[model samples]
Target: LLLSVPDSTTGTISVTGLNGASNPSFLGMFTTIAGFEPAGANFNNHYPMQDNVSDFHLYDIGEFFPIQPVADYNAETGIILPPNPNLSGQLKEYQIEFDGFEQVHVDVFGLVTSQNGPNIRTA
Candidate 1:
């Protein structure tokens, strides 16, 4: 599996075999805030596990709608609080899993930029 994050909000994940590795039977991805961990965080999203007509098995995060928080209301004061803050600067965690492989290898590469000029990489 190879993961690439070109920007803060968009990414592409690709899974492929090495020389003669067989195709996996399943593929899943799970994502959550880094500091704010959630329950059952593994493999929450599943993708179709089949041979693509094209040469790549890829999933794009931009194709899905962003997750939104529910509204919070104060019963006593009759006021609604604002939604959560944006994801900027906050760390995020992504987990990828698959089946039908005796062994698996994973690699991640990313380039993040901010208003200040600096490049960052994480493992």
Candidate 2:
């Protein structure tokens, strides 16, 4: 999920994963920049930030600084299951809430495991 904040205020965003049989896991959130060509064309770019090792000075560009989340409740390997009386059987629901600042872009990463197999997918 890509979120673009228009104002300079603190806010919270909620992400939910609904599945009939399994609960999806919420991974870490990250900020990224859009790649652009000099001729005005846009392209995909992969610039990963290393935790505790990445230098923001080398990647910072004016107002396009990295936006970090204030509080992430699901930034771990734990499974989140919200209480819902409407759900039954193997059905499960997961919700992740995080705080963010204004005038920034964020990406919410998540992981979902396949119920039929051992394969896992990223979202």
Candidate 3:
């Protein structure tokens, strides 16, 4: 889930996934990094502050910069993607960096074995 609030200083400009979720696990995946892309023609630079996890990975203007803005809540894996300046026509979507995985349940004791896979959900 994406949560956004208008900039206190710039009311017209709202940021998505800025404040971040208080409970990192609330959305199932811990929001290691979150950023916003403004609506416009040119590609602008935005900041994705480190929230629950440190070592936040960031991509800006064809370069990658990793920083630690928050206390350590280390992520097991890092999310990656090729750089896109257009960002799929800037609708103010939150660039969410998350490790997408789910738990599996198995009935080891029963003769009839049952297996379960991860649940899939859309934003």
Candidate 4:
């Protein structure tokens, strides 16, 4: 199952496996890491505030940035790409850095087993 946040433009995606029956299990996750491109693209140069939920976790724009400690959250993983979600669905204005211009196409592969049965309307 895929959940998208159309309102807000930026956020992380959490992939949980659900069996046909409970809570979902963690599969994989991924977050944006700034400063991977141009020299001026360092996260510290543009956004100084550190948000764990933000895709970019580290930036060295000529500053002593205390990198966000990597965790088992939805923003960190080698095999997961997070979906966008926002709390306020009305005002959705978000801008982020991506390798691709405008949009980025992602591919995910995993066998999700849900604990909730099909009777439950997750949609």
What TM-score, over all chains together, does every model reach?
0.21, 0.22, 0.14, 0.15
For candidate 4, lDDT tens digit of each residue in 77-101? 5554333343111111122234322
Q: Model 3 residue 42 lDDT?
A: 25
Strongest candidate by lDDT: 2
- The whole-model lDDT of each prediction reads 0.34, 0.35, 0.26, 0.29
Model 1: lDDT of residue 62? 22
Model 1 Cα lDDT, one tens digit per residue, 47-95: 2211221112223222112445534658999997666554222222345
Over 4 Å off, model 1: 1-89, 112-123
Candidate 3 overall Cα lDDT vs. reference?
A: 0.26
Candidate 3 lDDT by residue in tens digits, 5-77: 2222111212133333121222222233333322232222223223432222222221112322322223565
Show the lowest summed lDDT stretch of 10 residues, model 2: 55-64
Say which candidate scores most in TM-score: 2
Clashes of 4: 13
Clash pairs for candidate 3: none
Arranged by lDDT with the best first, the candidates are 2, 1, 4, 3
